[model samples]
Target: MNRTARLYALVEELRAAAPRPVTVAALAARFEVSTRTVQRDLQALMAARIPVRAVPGRGGGWSIDPGMTLPPIHLTAGEASALTTALAAVDAATPYADAARSAAQKIEAAMAGPAAAAARELARRIVTLPRPGDSAIRTAVERALAEGTVLLLSYRDAAGHESDRAVEPAGLLAADGRWYLIAWCRTRRAGRGFRLDRITAAAPTGERAQPHDLAELLSGSAAAGAVRPTALGPLPVAIA
Candidate 1:
């Protein structure tokens, strides 16, 4: 790999083994480079304020701070357009709906004048059908999920039984043009999928949400077939 690619790869390597140092010789062998070159690249990464640190001991070499994040790589005009198209294709009721729109805006802003315009034009040609739900409810769901907190929900079931529920926001599931909050329902004492439209009212409880195994939560559940795991982890996307 070139210096630039190697540098990015090195960050990922360290990040993957975060809190666990990788010896210099191991990194050099993995990247097929000399130990001296690896040391220099590590220096460059530190100079860039990438939160990389050296561990000084027999089994120590280098590690990246777990909280550190890298800036996104540059995108070509086509790539920019593809991102915009994807954002446009997402249903409006999806969690982080506003953030998704902002991401498309950021992608366009990063592109050159002509490329940005071209991406916009291409994005304009695409259309997504609107899903039924209040934007405020979606916003509340997004907040609870992003903050990793408990959600206070006034939900009405299909049988028209309305009840208040305290749920731990685990992830979102979008299916059949509607969105579901796949959360741990404290009231029900089990994993439940609350349809966004059925949520009459929602807010964050400010309590730390407990983590649950998403796969286990959805196992043998009816919604399982509607959500397929992607490389992006457990954030549910509609099965195409």
Candidate 2:
């Protein structure tokens, strides 16, 4: 199970045994993960404001207040299939790709057995082409964007000239059947769009990115018209 699904399952497990603590070791065993990993997951749940409590001492463990949790979701076969189709469209080049898959799995897992089977069959009828890109580079770019950090990139331009660059990830753009990482290039001292396929290597620098207006930068670019203002305009002001 991916971490996202595991987190969701962890909540369900606690909710099912509400008011009674389930030990960390037991949770680790149930999830087939290390106790340390369970601890981290618990911390993440807490960070997300989940109503989980860590009780102390013997016979103590983790528990959630069921009253505070949402009721089970029930999706029709067609609805579930619709979700699958949408999530499947999130390719390796997109951010949160893993999370999207995890969410789809959770949705299926939540469905009634027959409904889930029908959903699967319906999803199979729709075909999609595989996206081409390096998973490692995609992961690095996703992390840089998620954490608001600087990224180190090894890039080969159209001229086949290779160079190393440190950039602040601003956003991603999909144009002309390709994905581009829109970033503030430190080397060029300006905003630039680097094609994902041309990125030979990518790594997070672990440094927080300096603040910049991504929409303003994109508006000034030659490809500005190719990108819709609504794409960057609808973003929460705090995010911008």
Candidate 1's TM-score reads 0.63
Q: How much RMSD separates candidate 2 from the native structure? A: 8.0
lDDT of each residue in 61-99, candidate 1, tens digit only: 898887866545777778778888888777666777776
- Name the lDDT value of residue 52 in candidate 1: 92
Q: What local distance difference test score does each model get? A: 0.82, 0.84
lDDT of 1: 0.82
- Give one digit per residue, the lDDT tens place, for model 2 in 1-240: 878778889999999888999999999999999999999999988976778999999899999999977756766677787887677667776656777876776677666667778778776777767777688898999999888999999999999999999999888877887778899999999999999989999989899998766676687787676655453467666744
Please provide TM-scores, in order, for all candidate models, with all chains considered together: 0.63, 0.67
